[model samples]
Target: MPLLPGAEPYRHEGNEVGVLLCHGFTGSPQSMRPWGQYLAAQGLTVSVPLLPGHGTRWEDMQLTGWQDWYAEVDRKLTALTDRCERVFVCGLSMGGALALRLAAKHGEAVSGIAVVNPANKMHGIAVNALPVARHLIRTTKGVAGDIVKPGVKEVGYDRVPLHAADSLRRFLRLLDGELPQVTQPLLLMHSTVDHVVPPTDSARILGRVSSTDVREVLLEQSYHVATLDHDADRIFEESFAFFARLAPSVGKEGTATGG
Candidate 1:
């Protein structure tokens, strides 16, 4: 039988004040496992959902679109909000795009956002040149990079779906237009030497976001996947601190709240 809804091994639950972690494109919950583990240890409920067409086959990815991915995260975020007092979102790469969209559209419900190497634009001149290149670049081989774990080294889909890439481009365009709508505290962690998404993407985000409390941390030693790189610990430490500051304060009148 096919896996039931929310039956993936990645989902987990805990106390109130949930933290949702979204992994990058073609990546599974494994990419965010370390961060999720650390947060769960902190007594916060955590949910790391595998995006549609991922953690399975590359062809499956071609069959799916950005909407499918966003819908899945949306469901998890809604569930987290229903069960917790406040919700904070953290995402890596393409997942970061989804997280930003959530914050932009649901700013009233989100307490904070933590993004690692968010990809607001595709890298390389070819990506910019051929509007049809999105369909042409069908596969991206995983490299043995510093950011990937040994077992998870072969990251991303072997065959990148062109239609999906086009959909991603549309989403990025939408995010670019909606970024100023995000006014919550944001922590953007990006690697200076990232080989995938350009650092300029994060720089653009730092400049465009309307959030008054936006901070950027430069990971000098890592690559695109900062969440699993050598600087991953630092990402966790700083993110934990960011969320702590955003935690709702309890009033003397027996009410809990956050700004």
Candidate 2:
């Protein structure tokens, strides 16, 4: 699908330390561009690929599923990993799930992973309906831009695609089962008042992952799309600090020694 203007994929060349950012389901790379740029400004190589079914008309998304989405990110991440001596990943919502799965498959090859309001499991009985309802329903109200800060907006599909969401559930379940295999450092941040994905999903991930170094922070001022909300700067800075602790060389000027 052709990308909309201003919704194109973004890439910036920097040091051998690369950071791959993934946007959530139905969200275009626009949602993650700011974060990628922030990291790039810090002299880190960064890329945010528009997922297979995203950055175009909503109807176009109906033809794709989780595999297509994950493949795009996996390809970008592995490419970064192969080229860089150190690599980190960041994602929002379902993007977080993708990051976790990469950690499971790539192991310590991923230096660390940072995510905000990631969804692995949804709350309430509404989830049970996904199996049967996906066949009967085409779309539902989307969970996009669930930000508490007024006037802020997130770029995503207006309605949730049933088939794609169903595929996400299955993919998330698969990732959840493999969470124990994710031993890389993890930094998870969740909003206190998110209306889309609940806090339980974040808790569940912390409970399941075997990572020895784990940090969970509460975003008291923002909502689900905190990456674009009032606390956006905080998320970026904290994430940079998290990476700095692991890769101290990142903070110094001209740290790029080719891997």
Candidate 3:
């Protein structure tokens, strides 16, 4: 299948410290490319994998679910751990949930994590309707391009596959239980005026996670997709600094370094 423009995954093997980035639901790597490139330029090995059923058509997304999406990042994380002494996972929106899942599952293997507008649960009637809606409808309006910056658009499907969305709901529920398992340092950034996800999502995560090293940055000028919005540079710079501070230094042997 041909990928949409700007939907291609990104990878940069720069140093011993690795960062894995995950995009939002219905969003492609395009939403995360610039952030990944920025980190890569700062000498961190970065991987932004195109999740399965994403970067294609909405119909393709119906064929996949949260498990498929999480598996892709899970596999990528393992690959990074094999090559780098320390690895950090970062994600936006649903990707944030996936990143948290990785940190929960891997524990100390993940040095730390950073998330932008991370989502944990759905709000309003849609949450209740999703169970029945997935079977009755094929797709619904997509939550994309919620940016304050003019002329900037996120690369994602115009429609949200209902089946996939229902799966995401289930995934978030599972993630809530796993939040306490995320003990690594966490850097969370959220847009104060996000149109898609509410600020409460970030607050819920902070309250649930076991991580003592937690930092929160508020984006006043951006929306949901802050990574691609007005606060893009701030997100890039701060996250890089967060990972750098947590990453371990190379030892004399260099092969087996401290993390």
Q: Model 1: runs farther than 4 Å from truth?
A: 1-9, 128-155, 248-259
Model 2, residue pairs in steric clash: none
State model 3's lDDT: 0.91
lDDT of 2 at 233: 90
Query: Which of the numbered candidates is closest to the native, going by highest lDDT?
Result: 3
Instruction: Tell me the deviation in Å of residue 12 in model 3.
Output: 0.7
TM-score, each model?
0.87, 0.95, 0.95
How would you encode candidate 2's per-residue C-alpha lDDT over 136-232 as one tens digit per residue?
Answer: 9889888777877788688788888888888888898899899999899999999988887888999999999999999998999998888988888
| Over 4 Å off, model 3 | 248-259
Total backbone collisions for each predicted model: 0, 0, 0
Q: Rate the local accuracy (lDDT) of all candidates.
A: 0.78, 0.87, 0.91
Question: What pairs collide in candidate 3?
Answer: none
Greater TM-score among 1 and 2 belongs to: 2
Per-residue accuracy of model 1 over 116-176 as CA lDDT, tens digit each? 9998976655555335665557655542233643543534455566666767777888889
